[model samples]
Target: MDTTQRALAVGVGAALLQALMLIAFAWPAANIAPRDLPIAVTGPQADLVVGQLAERSPGAFDVSRPADEAAARAAIEDRDVYGAIVTGDGPPRVLIASAASPAVAQQLTQIGQQLSGGPAARVDDVVAADSDDPRGTAFGAMVLPLALSGIAAGVLLGLLIPTIGGKALGLATFGVVGGLLSMEVIQGWMSLVPGPYLVLAAVAGLVSFAVSGAVVGLSAAIGRAGIGIAALTMLLVGNPFSAATSAPELLPKPWGAIGQLLPPGAAASLLRSVAFFDGAGASGPLAVLVIWAVAALTLLGVGALRTRPANEPATAAPIPVTTG
Candidate 1:
């Protein structure tokens, strides 16, 4: 095709990409609602409250009957449930882990009010988010930038450093520096997270490594196209479905599960675990990040094996000699 035809094609392609991006981002936000959100309930009204919840929202909550208020509190602290309801004796009380998810906490508080047959119900935030970020807005907004940082690091390394070994080293360095910087800003400057300084930094670093490694690995394996693949996966699929702003249950089914598999989602969960839940629910997300990092390294190794270095001296063809 001529230049004008190519320009037109490019314009149309850009428009289509814009449309897809809009749908990817907006669809999840528009359709967000609880889907089997875990919660605990106790006391004499446990069965009745569970019944009401099921009747009202059908399949919205996955209710667990904890033995008592203490058990429910433990569940919330351990990251097993987002919230709990204690019904019996006095007015119903709601236990929430705002650090887990402020959106879920508000939802639980509302539910408690409804169950109480009063305008307000007693509410307690068993594990509250940091005071500076009470609503978790900062925390939620953090994942995208971190993901982008990793992507940028990988892209730069891929372009600037031609050697696979050099790229690997760059990715590791970026991960470490990026993690420390992110932690300093979010924890020290903003006080958004209340976790241990070094631990949070380490977690942040791991996330960075996982994301950058994936991008670098894919680029090494598939040339420039790998960059686009990694960016789109992290941005369109991983960021929106990450559930960073809300609980995984709040996101649409399958997508939420899918997000957890991606670096962004896994990062969010792992960060939250270390920051608020004392690493109670850390294993799964930690494993996910490890797997991603490993896969990226493996891809890098494959690329190294398959790709010929541009700087390598060409092998000399065997000189054929004819004797006269």
Candidate 2:
């Protein structure tokens, strides 16, 4: 295409990208309602409560009948469910792990109140979030900066560092430092996460390494286009669908689940796990991050192999040609 045509095309592309970004970020938020979110219900009124929930919200909650109130509390703590409804006592009690999801806790609290028919039911927060970030708004907000930072790291390494090995080292260093610095701000300064310092730092570091490594590895394997690919994958799809600001089940069907498979979503879940539930239900997210990191390494290796011959010593020319 001619220059004018190409410029026009670029403009159109930018507009299209803007529309896409809007949809990616807004769609989930607009449609923020629980779908199959797990909640435990127990006691003499368990069946009635479950029926009422199903009637009221219809498929919004995955009601589990834990043995009793204690069992229901255990479920919440184990991260098996976001909250629990305990009946058979005076007023229905709602057990919530606000750290797991403040939004869900609020929903459950409303449900508890509804169940009481008169006075508001007793609501107990089994795992409360940090007072500094009680609603988890600040905690969830951290993912964007981390993601942007990782993207920047990848772009810088790809442009400045010529060798795959050098890029790899840079990714590692960036991951470690980024993790520590971010935790210091979120955990130390803001008091966002309540987990152990070292543990949270390590998880945060891994998250950084995974995202940056993925971007860098993609660029190395596929040239400049790879950066675009990584950005679209991580930013548009992963970040929005991540449900970092809310629970995965709170999002649209399958998308929330899909988000958890990506780096940002996995990182959010893993961070929450370590921060509040003492690493409960952390395996899946941890695995996802590890898989991403491994894939990044593999991509870097492939890129190195592809570029190796360019660095090899040239064959010696015949010296006999100088015998004149």
Candidate 3:
């Protein structure tokens, strides 16, 4: 009823929403399942491996064939395939890209051992995660900071600038700088994500720009409520859906599909492409980020137009007509 009461209610609601967000993400994550995982196979026993997988797990794999070991390695490195099974005269060798998806890598190795003569098979990780980060924990950790940085840039800039042009300029600048700085800290200082410095930095910048633009646009359109909504969407919903820890197919039906459609998921996918996959699977994610950035910019433009004062001439002050 009162101002203080309304403010207190709003605060309480935000806190409650945050709790729900944690549950929304944690619940699905606690229950993990691998579905339609992509993999590559080649050589003599390739057909046998595929057949056995079909028999054993039904819909476990989306298998492809590479020409040779070299091609298989390439597929794994570029993330075109998460793991590759190369079958030959001796025990089958499983090549995995642990850096891309550590969980999938472990699964493939176990599968290889079973498929091979119990203890004879070898599991080789071509693009292994760094020793310090054996399971690519750093990959998952990177997304949180990136999302926060974007939100910070958006909220701060949106408050400081009244015009759309000013806000847009501020957000863009922050995206580029924040992106480069974050990469330098993560990769240069910490060696978390190792790749071509320039390319990685560029991808980071693009992601920052998209996230920042989205937040700023949303806030401009709906004031403080916009910021809260953006946080709920990106930080809570988007982060869990992002296939950072595992492949999209590994997640449940609607969730995997939903994550790809949002900014956080799209950005994480783009980062993986640049860092390890040589940008092989970047097109879809890159397109997604582009669309998000464009839409946010449009929202900002609309907000700016609405802020302009009305063109109708002001009415003159009421005449003091006194009947004496």
Please give the lDDT score for candidate 1. Answer: 0.91
* TM-scores, all models, native as reference: 0.96, 0.96, 0.87
Off by over 4 Å in 1: 309-312, 318-324
What digit string (tens of lDDT, one per residue) describes model 2 on residues 1-324? Answer: 999999999999999999999999999999999899999999998888889899999989888898988888888889999999888867788899999988898988988999898667798999998888889998889988888888888889888899988999998999889889889998898777887998898888998888888888998898888988997899999999989989999999899999999999999999999998989999999999999999999999988998889999999897765554
Write candidate 3's Cα lDDT for 1-324 as tens digits: 999999999999989987888787886687566788889999988999899989998988899999999999987877778889999988889998887788888888889989986865688889877676778788888887888788888778777787788988887788678778888988888887767888888778888888878888988877767877776688777888887777787888878879988888888888877776678788999999889889889989777766765434788999898997
Best by lDDT: 1
Candidate 2 lands at a TM-score of 0.96
Q: Name the 10 consecutive residues with the lowest summed lDDT in model 1.
A: 303-312
lDDT of each: 0.91, 0.90, 0.83
The TM-score ranking, best first, is: 2, 1, 3
Off by over 4 Å in 3: 2-19, 117-120, 310-324
Select the stronger candidate by lDDT from 1 and 2. Answer: 1
lDDT of 3 at 137: 82
**Candidate 2: segments with Cα more than 4 A from true spot:** 321-324
**Poorest 10 consecutive residues of model 3 by lDDT?**
304-313
lDDT of 3 at 214: 81
Query: Candidate 1 lDDT, tens digit per residue, 56-85?
Result: 999999999999999999999899999999
